[model samples]
Structures are given as structure tokens and as C-alpha cells.
Target chain A: MTTTEPGTAEEPGRAGPSRTQRLVMGGAVLLTVLLVGVIIGMLVRLPGQPPAPPAYDSVDVGFAQDMSIHHTQAVQMAAWERDHTTDPVLRLLATDIEDTQHGQVGRMLGWLELWGAPTMPLSGRYMTWMADAPGHDHREPGSSEPGVTQMPGMATAEELRRLRESTGPEMDVLWLQLMLRHHEGGAPMLAYAADHAQTPQVRNLAAQMLAAQTAESEYLRELLAQRGGTPLPL
Target chain B: MASGKTSKAARRNTPAPLKKNSFPWGTVTAVVVLVAMIAVIGTYVAVRSNEQQARAEALAPFTPTAQNPDPSRAIPGIVIKEYPGGSHVGPDEQVAYTESPPFGGTHDQVWAACNGVVYDTPVRSENLVHSLEHGAVWIAYHPDRVSGEALETLKSKVTVPYTVMSPYPDLDRPISLQSWGHQLKLDDANDPRIDQFIAALRLNPNTHPEPNASCQETTLFDQHNPPPYQPAPTPGTPGARAEDESVDPSRPMQTG
Candidate 1:
């Protein structure tokens, strides 16, 4: 038991607060300082909020995987032209296609690594991610199988064969036709990613691909027209 | 300040009653968690830095190979013929040549100055022999390979004789061979024929496509053409193979 004065009881302790009161006040100050320090540290450490965690199953991933496949075929076709065509302009274009697409493929693989995702998704149905997209028919209009039709402008086996067999001006014209269609197919995917991807890096890359492909597509159209051909109706 | 005083007093007392309020368990717990989180982040960064350093170290050995220089550098002087027919370049005279094709003068002519006299020849295998006979070291942008039979013929025809100082060897880059044909900076330029060969070797099938008689002219870069007509002239310096010794003339041309 300790001595207590009547006025001191009201005051809590002699000129100072009691041990309990002091402990409570000190604890409160310490708690505030720690909380503030933590918040400041974290805020300082935060890196632009890290472009919100990418959606695991997203339009962005689908676009990257599918477009990579598309670009691979384009590269293969371009390589064929480069090796076989005698036309200087066509050979130059083929080389450009091969070098640029190979670089883009590298970028996509890098993104997949950073996202901790597989290069391709475990989807039985390709392009199902775009079901909600209006005016985005991927098949011959009124086809029943939904996403079964080759996604817009893809060449069939026979078309690739014809490309390989023909040479000279005929080959150049056919290659330009097929490539222009392939770009048309690819443009929508890029546009979707540009509008919807969570990462600014992803969106910016998509926009760049869009601009480049669109310009190339226009050039192809002009090349075809110069050779007395027109773009095939989708 | 209060907490410091209370804790001190509690330590001094034999048995202190439990304080109504002491250290804030919530604040202490939060500070501990934050510190742990920061530690984890620091460790992650350090590990990543080490991995990058290790990767750079492992890729050091596979760099590309360099081009080999001409190794033959010895020859003896014998005789030389002057232009319009033949004359001798004295032992003290020099050779000056270029890759430029001959139009009016010997643009592609092989010329030598020896004993204060000048000798000139078309850049033919026969001329190469004449230059060597003058004790001149022959260098060409593109040295043509003479066939084994042709080399023998050249060896027999050479009048006042010398030796091959720097004979053509295999090269790694085809472009280097073709490009070198354009360079005429070395003393071998002292020969007049080398300038003619340089001009002839510049023809490209794509640029002109139709092969001209002049276009068939040879240079060292044209490895596919043929072997040296005779064994390469033996090096004349000490510690070198004897002049009677011979090099294989049928070695396969290295395809770049």
C-alpha cells in the first residue's frame, strides 16, 4: 500500500501523472510514431502502385499469346519470300518483317515471365475472351460453331501452298494479299488491349503494334493496287 | 517518458502491482511486422543483384574469331622486264601499283622500279613471277589463285626471278576478301599488274549479271577459282623452309 493525498488522487500523481497514466500516454505516443513511420516508409517504398496486378485471365494475355502465334506465321511467310523472291522491294520487306516480329516475340515472352503466367492459356476455346465484343464476328456471318472459324483473315493450307508454288510477280501479289488480311485480323486484338489492359506497359506496346501494322497494311493495299489487284472482301 | 520511469520503478520494486496501462501491445506488434516486411524486401533485392552478376560472367568465352594476316614475307630477286617489251627494275628500285583498271595507261598494270630502271606487265600470273624475280614483295587487294598446272607454267616462264613474299592464304570473311581487292596501299603496289586485277575484281553478277571477259579476272578473294599454278615461292629469310621445299598446291579452297 502506498500513501495517497486527497488532492493528489484527483491530480492522478504528485505534480506528475501516476505510473499507469504515464504508461498509457507514452504507449499512445509510441504507437502513433510507429504507425506514422510505417505509413511513410511504405509510401516511400511504393513504386507507382505497380500498375495494378495484371488480371490472371485477361484480354491482354489472350491477345499476346494469340498474336504471337499470328506473328510467327507472318514471319515464316516473310522468310519464304525473302529466300525465294527475286524482287528487291519484296525481299527487303520480308527481311523487315522477320526482324521486327522476332523482336516482338521476345517482348511477349518477357511479359509472360514477369506476370508469372504460362506463354499460352489453358483454354479449349480460343478467342472466347472476346465474346462480349460487339460487331466482332470472327467467322462467316451466321456460322453456328461460334469461335470455331479461323479468326478473321487466317490463310488455309491450300493458300499457303499456292504462295509457295507461285513465283515472280504472281508470288508478290499473293503474298501482299495474304499479309494484308493477316494484319486486319490482328488490328482488333491490339485495339482491345490498348483499351482494356491493366498495365500501361502492355497497353502502350499494343498501341505501337497497332500503329505499325495499320501502316504496313495500308502499304500492302497500295502495293496490291499497283499490281492491278484489290483487297479480298472479308 | 512515463513508460521509461514506470518500467525503471517496476525493475526496482520487489513485486510491483500490474500497471493499469503499460506498453501498447498493438503498436509494438505493428512495428515488429513492418520491420520484418522491410527485411524481406531487402533480401529479395540483394539476391536479384547477385544473379545478374553471375549471368554476365558465364558468357565471356564465345566471342567471334579475328581475320588472319598474310604470313609469307620472304623472297629473292632475279630479273625484270621493262614495259612495251621488257626492262629491269634494279635491286634498289621500287614497285607502285593500284586496283584501278587500265584504260589509257596501265591503270591495272604491274610496275616495278629496280636498279633505277622500270618494268611493267599486265597483272597476269606470268607477271607475278617477273615481280618476284625483282626481289619485290607482291601484295594485291585480291590475289588470284593459280591452278597447280598454271603455277608450274608461271614458274618456268619467269625470266629475271624473285620469290613470293606474302602469298594469299585462307580468310574468314568473304566481304573482307572482296573489299580488300579495292585496297592498294602496300608496296606490292610497286607492281603495275595488281592495279588491273583490282579493277577487274569489282564486277558483281547482280549489278551487271552478264559475265564479261574482264569480270573473270582473279583476286585472292576468289578462293573458288583455282590453286597457285606453282608451289608458292619459298620464303628467303633465315629459319625458313629451303627454296627447294614445296607447298601443296591442291589444298581445298576455304568457303567462307
Candidate 2:
């Protein structure tokens, strides 16, 4: 038994590792690699680093770009109405929309400038950033032609021409109809941004826009109904 | 007990009996781990480099530098002129401009409301030129030549603020883009240079006299009933402001 004990110990020392021993060594290597990887990742994301600016394709940048374009048209329509409409109520509503949306445009444009993103979309496409958003379709419908696809609730050139030519009660009704639909169409975008934007300021702005547009929509509906004008189809 | 002792003695005597059966599993695992790590890091670096390359390519031509004060100079067939700013003319007067749609010169006291405005009818050149002084891009298209899909294409680019589009009656070209001191005429509305012009010069402080002037026309001008376009006054016509004529120092400069 004394000779067997020495032989067994000496054999293990001379021979290659056994299966269990090999497994332990492999596990040790794996653990070392994993620890190194974790350290590198932690260093990259260290809180001491200044926060990274939003990437070009980030949700915050996309929302600001798309919403700025959307609000421009609204401001244009409102500005026209504010100048031309004779009805006191319609004029008041138009003024509010003009002032609020114009200011909002300035704010969004300022954010985009700060983010170092183009004021216009680089792709010249709208709503592309909402591809993964639930219930939102960013694809242009039916027409593959580059510029034919417009955002929801945008007035056609013909419709705008008609509005420009119309006077008195006709102009009032048309403005309400158009603006009401514009508010409704933009609601979904505001909601999506509110939930998905990476920056808190963007999310807060989107939430505020959603709430204000919702309230304005109600007022628009009431005003349109009083004027016996039907809302435009979305 | 005797058989167990015999087996233990045989196992001890045969040195490296399991060595022949060993498959070098550790070496294989190490190689695989090393290769995976390289692939992960390599892929990440490649993707990041590609993104940076694409962004650089997109903005390179438009970004201004000290050597190239005006980046729009790279655009093909663009016309650059040196027109002094803050030259104001009365609404009733006309500027005898060298270019058909003058890029810059003496202009009306009032500027066209150019906050993404699309005027169905042709707007007066005097007022439109005033907008150009305020760092707005004017997209003037021939009404007859640009219709259907072509018209839509031009309108899409004007949706951003600091842009305005309207019909230019009897335009020599189908489309013409104008910033303060620049102009590019194109036969097709879908021409890529249309966007390039806008991206380079719209609201560019280096290109325009008034950098932060408001595009919104609060009081002086009426956008809905804007002044109608008329032919540029004949060069020596009475009371016409010549393109190179100096501004009247006594008159107050009109700020957009």
C-alpha cells in the first residue's frame, strides 16, 4: 500500500491532465476572459464620462426633425388665417396656433442645432425613425415617386389655392376643417415621441404637445361644428 | 481485495495511458474563444467606422471652411454675385437687375412672408429679393413647365422653414434656386443640386447680410394679398433703381 500511494501520485504528475482537470482549466480561462470583457465594457460606460450626444439616427433627433417640418405647415396655415380671417373666434384660434407652433418650431430647431443634426432630414424622408414604433407605418403608400408622398393631413397645393381664393364665411369654415384635421393627424406622432424619445426634454416637449393638441382639437371640433363645417378625412 | 490491488498496480505502472486518448480540447476551446473575441471587436470597429464615413460624406460638401468661405461654390453651374445688402427701395419702384430673378439688390421695404410659404401665384421680385436678404431661399419654378410630379418634387424641398416657392412667369429655366448672393438654374425639378443649394446656403450667415432676421412678416406685409410681379424696369427708365446703384443713406434701412 505504501508503494501504490507514491506510484499513484507520481503518475498523475507525469501524465496529461484527466478529463475533470481539463474542464476546470477551461472554466478558469473562460472566467478570466469574461471578467476582462466586463471590465472593458464598464470602462466604456463609466458615469464620469460626459454624456454622449444623440446619434444622427437617435429617436430624439428624428422626432425633432420630423415635428419641425410638420409644425412649419401648421404655422403657415395659421399665419394666413390670423391675417385674413374676419371672424373674431376664428382669428383668435388662428393666432394661438400661429404663436404656439411658431415658438415650438424655434425650440425644436434649436435642439437640432445643438445636436449637430441637419435641420432637414438627410434622407429627405419623413417618419422613417418610427419604423419600430407600434402601429406606425413609415412607408409611403402606393407611390414610389420620391416627393409625391406627403405627411398626414398636409394640404395639397390645390386645396391651399382654393383656401387663398375663398373669402368671408367660406374661408373660416375651410381653415377650421383643415386645421382640425392637421391636429388630429399629428397626434399619433406626438404620442410615439413622448413614449420613445431618449432625452427627457424631448419626451416632455412631446407630452406637452400631445396634451395641447388634444385640447385644441376639442376646441377645433366645437368651432367647426358651430360653423356647420365637416372635418376633412384623414 | 487481491484483484483491486493488482489493478491499481497495473494503472500506476503504465505512464501516460490516457495521453493517447486526450483530444487537446483545451487548445481548441482557447482558439475558439480567441477567434470570437477578435470577431466581436473587429465587427464593432468596422460598423463604427462605416457610420462615421457616411456622415462625413453627407456633410463634407456643405460644411464651410476658412479656405472655402462659401461652400456653395462647389455646386455645379451656380452663379455668385457681389450684391450689397440693406439696399431698400419703395414698393412702387423697380430694380433694373442684371439677372431675370435678381438674387440680391435694392429691394422693397417689405419682405415676402417666407416661413415655408408656397405661393400659388407669382410674387413680386422686389419683395422676394428682400426675403433673400433675410437669409431665405427662394425656389421659383415656371408654372407651365413644372406641374404634376415635377411640381410636387419642388414643393417637397420647400417644406422646411426659411424656404419659399412660387411660380416665376416666363422663366427661362424650369426651376431656379436663389439665396442671398447665389443662384442655380435647373431644367428639372428633381435635379439633386436643388437640395444641395438649400443645404449649403439657406440661412447661412456667411452668405447673407441679415443672419437672424425674422422670416415671419408680422406687420408691414400681407402674404395673402401680396404685390403682383411686374417686368423689371428698363435700364434707364425714370425713377428705376439700377442694380449697381448705391443705397440712399438718408432713408432708414428696412430690416426683415
Candidate 3:
């Protein structure tokens, strides 16, 4: 039961729309504003926020865990050379290897901790994650068997024992041979992660590792050849 | 416009439907949701900002790599010395050196391990200088003075090979990082130049006299059991430990 005149109010002096109409229009405008605000908030946030975290078994986590283990062996082998060799060039190389790989290990552990993932892989089935990655060949490497070779580039228990016992040129040559093979073995895994890992950090780290190892591998070959030796069989 | 004479009369007779006032639940709901989103996102952004800042402060601002090997930083009073193979003194005893903890000079032919060793006790100067000859950067930190973040930085940097850190109870400065013929003294462990000094010298064969010298296991002297650091006893002084405090039992007579 309200006034229906287009330009007149029930009260004669008031020439504009009545209070009820104003309230209804204001509420409608406010509702529209709220709707628009919410739509914008969601749309704006879509790209502003961080991307979803990697899965527990994602390439990022797997690469970090496996590479950390690989780096450990490299550090250990380099330490052996540092503690046993007399050749100036070999010592220089050993120091470089030990320092570089050790730093890389620390960086990997930090990333794993940030992701809340376990530093070590579940059980001993390491490097299996790389199997399904693009261009991978070892879908079921079968490293779990008692003596089927648990890890590529890793020294055998017998070999490690002998390395500890050996010294002089015999030890120097053995260390170079073992480390060269180890770096070559790790190349495939590094390349896989560089191409497949989702996180930029993971991909970049893998690329860096690949570049460093490739260069080091070349130098190690030259050093070995200079000393009248060659890289050990894979 | 419709003249509403009929509607005016109707309003007069029935009375306008009682004017109603309702809560603005829709606007309130939108406001609450928007505020919650801001609070959560704001907190996340704040936390992330803090974490990144902390990480930046912990490490040196720039990392020197092989491509950028020299950071072009200089040591304040780096000592340089040139000594030949036969110049280092006898292996059986401590020798006199002009530098406090000799960076390089004639010392024992045998060198203490520089394979990233952190000596719990102060090592003899003569042996340590040999490590310098082999291109090892020696980092000396005082146990009582350096601790916390600065100490952590020192420890992390020394973890790399061709570096060694030891406790110097009587160091004039809190920390002294030395390579063959080069030394830098500083009071703060977080000093950016610490890593700069290391990057320029550690295994950069150009600076080392015996860049190829062995740092492996030794037969000359046990690293664990080495003579302590002390001002070498004068040649004329009574060789007895009772007469000379600097003349420890392990070190023989110091020739001037």
C-alpha cells in the first residue's frame, strides 16, 4: 500500500523516491558489489598463491633422497683420496670433490626437511622412482635381490674394505677408477630429474649436478689417463 | 507517470504494510569471508618473508664459484713468505718463526692434516705452516670468544676440504683465517670476507708453493698428539721446562 507515482512522494514536499525504494535499491547494489568482490578475490588468488606442494613420491622428493645418497658415496670416496694420496693433482681433485659433494648433500637434506619428507628412502629400493620418469629404462631394476647390485656407482663392500686397506699409487688409481665409474653411473638419474621434476628448485639442482658431474667426469678421465690408468668397468 | 489517486486512498484505508527492518546477513557474510581470506593469506606471506630473510642473513651474500673464483677481496695485513723444500726445520722439534701462527715459512717437513680438520687443541705452528705450504687455509677460532651464529658459519665453511679450524686460546683477534702466506684477522665470524678469503686461496694452486704436497695420513707426527702452541724458547734459555714456560716437553730448543 505505497504511493505509485513515478516522480512524486506521498509527502508532497519530497519530490524524489520514498525511503523504502531507496533501501531496496541500495541493498541490491550492495549485494551486487559483494558478489563482484568475492568473484575477484577468487580469480585474483588463482595465480598469486604458491603452486600445490609436490606429492610424497613426486620426482622432487625422490631425486633429493636418491641424490643425497649418491653424494654421500662421492664424499666418502673423495675423503679417501684426501686422506691417502700424495700426488698434488690427485689431492687437489680430492679436495674439490669432497667439498662440492658434501655441500650438495647438505642442500638436499635441507630441501627434504622443508618438504617434511624422510631424508632416507623407504626401505632399500632407492632410485626406483626414476624408472617411470620420461626416458627411464630401469622400470624394475631388481636391486632388492641379495647380490643384484643395490645401487649404481656404489662401491662394493669388498671394494670399500680394500680401499681402506690399500695405499700409495695402488690406492690413488683405485680411487680415481671408482669415482669415475660412480659419476658416470649417476648421470642417467640426474638427466632424468632435470627433465621430469615439477619443482623449479628440483629441476635446477639436478641440472647443476649434471653439469658439474659431467665436467668433473671429463677431468677425472684426463687425470686417470695422465697417470697411466683408465676408468674401471661399469 | 501514473497518477496514483486510487493507491493513495488504498494506503490511507489499510495502512502501509508495517515497515520492516531486517539484518544485512548477505553483506555480513561476504565481509566475514573476505576478512578470513586476507588474514590467512597475510599470515602466510609474513611467515614466508621472515624465513627468506633469515636464510639470506645466515649465508654469505654471494657464493664464489670457479667461474667467479676471485671475489677481489683483500686481507688487511696478509703475511707472505717464500721457503724452499729443505728450508723447513727439523721434524723432531718446534721451530722459531717471526709470524705469530706462521702462515708460511721454514718449518717441519711434516705437515699437520689440512683435510678439513678442526683441532680440539691448539696445534704447533711449525707443523701447521707446512699445511699452508700445501695450500690449506687454516681457520683459528677462540673457544671462549666465538660461539653461536658466527661459530656456526665458521664450522659450516670449514666442513669443505683443504680447510682446517682450531682453538687458539691466546689469539689477539677472535678469528684468524690463513692460507699459504696469507692471513686475515677479524672479530666477527659472520664477516662476509671469510668466505671471500677462502674462495680466492683454497686449492687455487697459483698461490701455493707446494700445491701438490700430500695432506693424507702421515708418519711424521700424529695429528691428534701434536706439540702445543707457545712462543718458542730462546736458544740460550735453559731447555728445562721448569725454567721456560714456553718450552714444553715436546718442543726441543728453539734456535734464533
Candidate 4:
């Protein structure tokens, strides 16, 4: 055996670094791993925010519903001209009206279904859905004079009767005149729906209706002028 | 004896019980991390599935199609989703026909036939006829022979100078009273042919009538207008007759 110095010889029980040092190193490694994990987790989570559901209550719903009904009537009157009128161009014009309105009605009904709502909302009043309209003051249901309370541009009972009674060119001219007014009433509501509806589908369909009806209105005006008739004062 | 005693002492001292790590720290940590990831991903999938189910259930009750709301209008709104066309070989064999407005039967049945579309109800038939008159054809039948028969009959019976061909004879609708050179109107109550066509058509209870007063008029069922009004063939003769150009507004055919 050789003589050993007091300090140079290690304690038999101690083999390496002290426990504190080992702990410090392990902790450092753990911290680095945790830090990297957290950064990756944050990056992975960033894109997860969901889109919001379309927000609408009865107002938007009512416009789509009621306006669809209004358009149907207009379609009916236009169809009458398509059949009885001898004019080929007029007949073609009526076809356009029917086709466009058919599409519009379908889309509106689609919205009601999408929203988990009833087809005919149980609202008591007509145009109440438009109550918030700025300065528009649509006629309240059942409030106006008995006769004039008819939806705007709707033909009077007498006028419809006359249209039924007349034949040939007379029927043709009157039908066009009445339909022009009917569409005139529809344009404003279409504009409102376009601007205010909550759903993109609703707004898009409304805009299309507005554009189509407006164009149709122009055509009807020109047609009336050609027939030596004027637009019925709304 | 001294050496033996030293060994015994060494044995009695015993090495400290070797430490056994009862808690597998590394493996436990790995398992915990894996479990956490699974939990998070499972939650995400469940949420997504729930949302999809909600959307599907919401759309389930209302079936959608390209059908017109009014059935009577010419363009019945529904059409066959697909069709293929071939080049025309000759006018006699031509499949293309002029369609009038209120375009109906253009392609296919909306629901029933291989090639027809049906609109929802409330729209009247007169509207459909008017559209047809204006040159809109509701694609009625596929271009196959059986489907082409009605079209051929329509061509022969309704157009002026009626000439019929085989494989598609003129189909007489006693209700329509549509024979060679004449077709019944929706409103004409007096035409024996129309009455007959009506009687035959009644076999199909679903057949809809054109709405309103104009149904009384003598409708030209086929789109072809007469090549100027030729005088009727002299009694008991089959040769050419005189022509009358004047519009006889009063002679509108009445069934009553």
C-alpha cells in the first residue's frame, strides 16, 4: 500500500458530484424541455378559434318570409300575361319573372330551414319585422284605411275583377300595369333584406332579388310606355 | 481466529439495502403526457362530431330540389340534372323542338320520370301552357324512341298541313280534342273532341287544369300557328280551299 494525502483521497461513500449539483443539472434539462413544449403547444393552439353562428331573430326571418309571399303574388299576375297576351316578347318577359321568383322563394325557404325555424313565423303583424327600419314607416298590418291597406301595388279588387273580365289587348295592358306596381312594392323590402339580413346567404339572395326586380321594374316601365300606358301612381 | 472474527464483523455490518425505485418516475411521466394528449384530442373530435350532427339534423326534414313553387307555370322550376345531345341529321328526324314559355318538361320529371321535373302546387296550368306557346319547352322525355313519341304526335296533330308518321302516331286526347289541324282549349266547353280528350285525361286524377276564365278560349295546343287561315275543305272534298287573312275576333271557338 502507498501513503495517501488527507485531501487527495475521496470519501469512500461519495463517488461523484454532490446531490445538489445533480439536481441543478436535471432541473435545467427539465426546464428546457418544458419551455420547448409550451412554445409548441401555443403555436399548435393558435388557429382553433371557431367562427360565430349567424345572428338573427324574427326581423331578418320575417323579411325573408313575408317578402317571399309578396313575390309569389307578383309571379301569379305576371303569369296571367304570359298565357293570354298575344305578344311573344311579353310572354318571354313573363317567363323571366316566373323563373327568377321561383329561385328566390326557394332560397328564402332554405334560410328558414337552416335557422331551425318555422316556415311561417308566428308573428302577429305584417311588416313588424321592419320596425327598426330608419324612417321607412312601413304600413302597420290592419292599421291603414280599409281599402288602401292592401299591400303596396297590389291590384284593387275591382281592378282584378276588371282584369278578369277584359279580353285580348285590354287584359294584356292592365296586367302589365298592375304587375309594375306590385314589383315596385317588392323592391324596397328587397333592399332592406340585402342591407340588414344577418346571414350571408340571406343577404346575398336579397341583393340578387333587389337587382333583378329593379331591372324588371325598368323593363316594365319601358313596356308600359310602349303600350301607351303610364306607371300606376303607387 | 482473529482473521475469522474480522470477516464476521464485515458480514454483520451488511451493505446498506440496495435502493429500489418503487415509483418508476420516467415511465409514469411518459404515460401521463400521453394520456393528456389523448384527452385533449378526444375532446376536440367529440366537439366536432357534435357540431356536425347538429347541422345534419337541422337540415334533415326539408328536402331541397330545383322545383318551381307553382306547378302550372311553363317553367316548372324542376329540371333533369343532366342530359346529352347529339347532332341533328334531318328535319324529319330532328329531336329539337321549339318550346314555349312557362318552360315545363324541358329535361325530366322532377320526381317520377327519368326525365321530368315537377313543381310544387298552387301555380296554375294555363301559365305553363302560355310559356310553352312562347317557345319554352319543358324537357319532357329523354331522346329515346318511347319518349320521342309524344313529341312527334304533337308535331303532326297541331301544326298546319298536318302530316303524320308511324312509330309515333298522333295521340288523340279526347279531353284535349286535339286532332289533325285542331287542338282544344282549356276553356272550350263545346268542342266534342275536347270533351272526349277531357274524358280520357280524367283517367289520371292528378291532371291539373289551367286556372281562370281564359281557359274558355280555343287554345292552340301545339305551338305551330296556321300558315295563314285557309278556308275549310269544301263539304265531302279533300283538296285545297280558299284562305282568309282577317282576324275574326268574334268567331273565337266556344264550347258552350
Rate residue B221 of model 4 by lDDT.
26
lDDT of each: 0.46, 0.78, 0.67, 0.43
Best by the lDDT measure = 2
If ranked by TM-score, best first, what sequence of candidates would result? 2, 3, 1, 4
What value of lDDT does candidate 4 attain over all alpha carbons? 0.43
- What does DockQ come to for candidate 4? 0.04
TM-score of each: 0.43, 0.68, 0.46, 0.40
Root-mean-square deviation of Cα positions for candidate 2 versus the true structure, in angstroms: 10.7
Which of candidates 2 and 4 is the stronger one according to lDDT?
2
- Model 3: per-residue Cα lDDT over A78-184, one tens digit each: 87788778898899999999898878877875675555454445334566667654455454444433211255787774676577678988888888899999999
lDDT at residue A93 of model 3 (Cα atoms): 91
Better of 1 and 4 by lDDT: 1
Docking class of 2: incorrect
Candidate 1 per-residue lDDT over residues A192-219, each given as its tens digit = 8788777787789889999999999988
How far residue B228's Cα lies from its native spot in candidate 1, in Å, is 42
Candidate 1 stretches greater than 4 Å from native: A1-15, A18-28, A36-47, A137-149, B1-256
Best model number under DockQ: 2
**Model 4 ranges off by over 4 Å:** A1-56, A139-150, A156-158, B1-256
Task: For candidate 2, write residues B93-199 as lDDT tens digits.
Answer: 88887788889988887899887788899989999998999889999999888899999888877766689999999689899999998999999877888877887
- lDDT over C-alpha atoms for residue A197 of model 3: 93
Which candidate number maximizes TM-score? 2
What is the C-alpha lDDT profile of model 1 across B134-192, one tens digit per residue? Answer: 22223322235443453333332221111122233332211111111122233232333
